[model samples]
Target: MKRRHFAEGAVVAALAQAVAVPAHAQTRPGGAGWVTSWAASVHGPYPVGNPSAQPEQRFLFPSPPDGARDQTLRLVLRPSVWGRRARLRFSNAFGTAPLVLDGVHAGLQLGSATLVAGTNRPVSFAGTGSVTIPPGGQAWSDPVELPFAAEPASPLLAGRKLAVSFHVAGTSGPMTWHAKALQTSYGTAPGAGARGAEEGEDAFPFSTASWFFLDALDMEAPAGTPVVLCLGDSITDGTASTMNGDDRWPDVLARRLNAAVPNRVAVVNAGIGGNQVVGPAEYGPGKPFPGGPSALARLERDVISLSGVTTVVWLEGTNDFSRNGNASLEAVRDGMVEGVKRIRAGVPGVRVVGATVTSALGSSSAAHGHQGQDENRKALNTFIRDGGLFDAVVDFDRATLDPGSGGLRPEMIPESTTGGPGDKLHPNRAGYLAMGSSIDPAAVLPVRR
Candidate 1:
């Protein structure tokens, strides 16, 4: 839906042209066209606590420490649905310090679905496996630059995973994974692992947003193929998804699309934990406990211009409702409006699918969640669901809340999913799954030929 017109001709024309638009601008005004978000894929941060990262939790874990010495994680995944070649993304978007790793290998599955898949091929970063990720920054593997591909493999990753066994010279910290990292890893002190490390470890972290920056794991469609990006806060990051499980709804959804659909879509998870949509206040841009920087500050850089990004699945603002933001409903809503406007300006006609702020009411967390927070969420949801502002809406608020309790469902949210109710603010893997499932395929683009 278009915004209500208030400006006149030239000004409106300039505004229209200014958004970070795809190169295929019609070269004429008021003509006919919709910028298709081609080669767009969806994904999210998988959360996990690494025993090596947290020694206290080490014994509770079953695997050996990875990356502690310079480990390698190998993922063996074969795309069931193929298309033009695609680029791969590795993230360190949230690290507080520098990141380093060696040897990233990507290849077709060999004898088995295991990393031991015999006779597999090697994938390179830009061209080499070794790379560095600056604090709070991200990088992408050089495009595989292969030919258009397809699959008879009915299943997207039918028994496929990654084999990332590298040598760690240095790091910001221990690797914590959410959604159980999709690859097998080992750590050998820098310069270690001359050949490769063991594929299996005792356990792996299923971290949501902190996918340890990333190793060579993505299969990018050619520049013009279809892909979508999901960008936002903890919710979008798969915070509560299973460790090394890759079950975040978006992950789930990606597998679904790649497996059964003809669009050959991919999903990229750009969710940052504790991200906010209104100010630079979150990521400590200015003060302590500052939440992640506001969405506005980084939207143009992270979302609008991402490679192969066509459609953006945007969800955020729950942090705004918290006391930390101290933002009024009116002010926050206006902030969202502005964020959306800025986005349209950058990627002209790029579809923005907005997910309403879910309920934080009745959170068991003694910290906050008063009636006020709940009310604000409801108000924000109303504005978002009201079509004209966003091209589409995904009302997850209507999904996780218990119809009876009006909070997270007590049943669907057992101790495991709800984190045993300690601080009801964040859910466990199960809860994250519930939230992820709330995404409706209809809200995103339908299967387009």
Candidate 2:
């Protein structure tokens, strides 16, 4: 496939060449401190919350079985950037009462429910191995040094995975989770007690594709490593991407950046399938949908609060024009404008780039394929492209749409997961690759540290 990062814009060409420069010479944002390498935007407690077009059985956990009481959860995540010292963030953002957790551990993931021997490390909060997170609150574990010899600049650690294990002390009233991980993470049966210290799979027999409790991960990196946050809906969340495949647009962009410049930047996804830019005015433990909160309500937590975020790419708004959303085009545009304003106000120097929504004119899904919705999507895209509200624009519509039909390109219509004709609303792996490759890396990495 053609590469987007190899293009020859003067600014980008200069920045691309600078990727190999010494880390000390670059302008690191956090002053050689910790920055988020991976993150999942938490929606609400599992079982009772929204999952946005995902199959129902995937989330049928802590139920039909013993329940989530006293169980250990070992989540596996791929860090975009590596560090010698690592810390994790756990959320009780939608919980009803105090959520007590203990027996936190981190290590390199070897395989299913297994960690590399002698590499496991304990994670603590406030000098204790356990802590109680109050309702609607979140906690960050104290830094735990990774035992691996790979430093931040080590090529050996590139594409490596981390297994983070923790036990819920008692009955978690409601669990906070990111429903569609697209990656399998291990979990233990209810009443399994604290087994985060165990390296074998004996403690964790149950399997899930979703991540619970824990949210974001941060690691120390060289100063100035650009952290790019991709914010949007299902397309950005890799809806039709391969199961267990990190083929999301952001993932593709990350690999492209890594190939050109090993560790100059890290890309994290903040998209939620079925997410809308506006509407669903009230969201929380109450009134939860498969689509979490509106983009406006979540911008502060999902985009602004992330560490070392230098750029944001937003590709959303289809959900707003859907039958369920019913939001006017004007409302959606206003929301996008407000979101950009808020990001600029909150982050100061961060750049927000608008991404045109891809075509869904012929989608077979219940919520899409209407001409009215198509018109609204086109209107929104026009605003995203012509409206001077953003620092720059990525014309995804032009990249993915068929000019003749005003629908998704035929090659982009097959689902990567089930291997059938896709709904046309969400793009397949090939489509994502095209979309990811379409992004001008120069526009994203303007600084090119």
Candidate 3:
């Protein structure tokens, strides 16, 4: 075997001594194991969805069809929880051809595209440096130890972001991507070739506010570390919140959980901008929609298939009531009911919490602000609070609604992302903080023994 393969095999063997199971195995009964620390639900192929604050990509990816050719992309993301061993998952769920990736590395971000010294580590797949994922497929990397994260609960590591670098070996036809990353990531010009091994920013000349191919990051944590997934639309996806500030409602909730439990729990966001509980009845690469897929359609891949999820906080349905969707109130309600049943069946003993839909009574967007939309939203909120379908309920509607105006609170109207009088639909940073703080941590997490 090649020396590189031998080294990877040794790493796997060392991990087996601690895990006793394959790297893909998520939970291990009563022992510390893998838990999803960060995740982004991919919607569709490139340039087909809503992207916030996106820069022109003509230079880096001149042709969307050809997609990343011999280029390196360094994606930066924050993990809610830290651990010594980490693994990554890359998706081709929306690709039309095989996605060939190689020269992968993971390290601590040191601003822009540079990585912290002595922290970058090679990532492999089944003891190989590369992997080819067929269309509509995904692959997970072998476990690699994070030397900087030896103390998983270290305060110094809290809020730190991880930089994952990878090279697209050939033309990646129609790359599967999460459009609204809202966090800056660096990429090299097309044909740059194998720059993933570099630790400097010079090789990476361009930047993007989106994430491509890579989707989920898993970390070994104490057994039974509850992972609370916030699944919703733009609000849950941090639409109007500050960019790169990590002040989304889900981010705020993670901070709250960290303070109370101190790395004992993880919160991951699986929200897609413009996503709905129902509508767009069918979706795929051929019939791509900006919202990607419906909540019921993506539940398995976004929620059930993730690692060590113990609770799911479902907050959606606003988009379904939008003029673009015009779905009936009953249809959305039934979708949620069915979606909950599927979650229960897929992950036994998982708690599903329903968050009431916030008001879009006078949204600035052309697709929303209709009286009919607000009516349906109010009706859905009632059902979510009293429907008895969810294990628990979080009243996000009440948290942001202004009783007098029947719209978003006055203070929540100013946008925090790009700075403007905010859209009446999504809340600003202050509003997100209110929504995040409203959740009782005890409701989402089990009491410490």
Candidate 4:
């Protein structure tokens, strides 16, 4: 919204001069060009797991006949960049017991739960086809060659989707998952064992909006390739966007970058719906929040430790101002400062960009739209913009706000997920397109050494 008082003059003036840079101009640290092409921030388990912005009925998975044993998960993921080889990472971070996985496969996705004919290839861990991850832990599979991308930056790889299929070996007590996938991932009936290698959707009939176990996907790319990590809440997580639409702001940014810089940069999203920049001090398998952990809590796992993370675009903090959060603007700013410090410490020379929080003054949600919440949000945005806390800033507030209403733009109100009137909190696909396009690619590019 055009609040002359709220929009810090410095931020407005700075955003006017932001520009886009050539991908080749940015330098990549670490000789290994292993950038994360895809990622889903692990929240908790499914079926009454973490609270999510998505409709509850969408995650209504059929009861496991044998309690999560011998089942297969056919996950569909769209990588932001192309590569000839890829590695898979699975999480048991919330499981009460160990998670055993076997019969892992990755191939070009043809459609729902189906892979392109004869394209499925086996995946392994430490040279073995199976891997066991202990409770509260994670595992990364060995790299498997992608048969299609024989040449780097192939035109065939554009807008390509991958179907990663894997089977759970035994009982998994509370699966670890990214609760709001917003994409349809398939699963097999309980006791339906090891169907990952089959490449057929017949064995899988159940549908879930959450991604189980599988989280990060890293691709081998050319040296100096930049991986732009988008870290934030539902806006960054693609809420209100169509199911499997791949139209989240980060996704839009990724598509633009892929078209503009081709093989030079990868955009990975680590946004959790309902996420906050701070507060909710307690979190884990037992104590869960739909938003997962606070931004400060997840900075290490979601941003710092990620592979090839040369730059981070943080777009969060709306939740921190929610009544439930009741976080002070100073607290939120401190959290952002700490998060930036941690990211810099963990990944030296990484670029951290801050995004202005969009207006939620007229949100339907009760937790928001209270007196002073807007002030806190604006103050935080001002700190983000003019406090010298970030390498650069993206004015998302200006991009999505309605000057008169102090809410989402009129055209961005309809929910893109179900094609209905929206709650006016989360922006629709069209709004995301605007926010994505608003981001100056140059602002997110790694700083010159």
Query: Candidate 4 residues 1-449, lDDT tens each?
Result: 22112123432333233223323222235444577889999877555333333443332334422236788888888888877788888988777788899999999888888888998999999999899999889999988998787765877777778989988887877777887788887888778889998777899888777788888998887665677899988888888888888899998777766665455578899988888988689888777776787888888778877787878899988889898798888888888888899888888777899999988887788988765888888888888899998999999898888878878899998988877788787899988988887876667766444
lDDT of 2 by residue, 249-334 (tens): 89988887776666657899998878899978999876677788899998878888778777889999999999989999999999
Which portions of model 1 miss their true places by more than 4 Å?
1-86, 90-101, 107-114, 125-139, 145-159, 170-186, 189-210, 215-218, 222-224, 255-263, 279-291, 415-440, 446-449
Tens-place lDDT digits, model 1, residues 346-395: 87656688887766667665534678888887878888888478778876
lDDT of 1: 0.49
Flag clash pairs in model 4: 51-290
Best by lDDT: 3
Off-target runs (Cα >4 Å) in candidate 3 are: 1-25, 28-30, 446-449
Candidate of highest TM-score: 3
| TM-score: the better of candidates 3 and 4 | 3
TM-scores for candidates 1 onward, in order: 0.68, 0.92, 0.93, 0.90
- The order of the candidates by TM-score, greatest first, is 3, 2, 4, 1
Which of 2 and 4 is ahead in TM-score?
A: 2
**Candidate 3: pairs in clash:** 413-422
Rank by lDDT (best first): 3, 2, 4, 1
lDDT of each: 0.49, 0.81, 0.87, 0.79
| Candidate 3, poorest ten consecutive residues by summed lDDT | 1-10
Candidate 3: tens digits of C-alpha lDDT, residues 220-255: 997767788999888899888888999999998888
lDDT of 3: 0.87
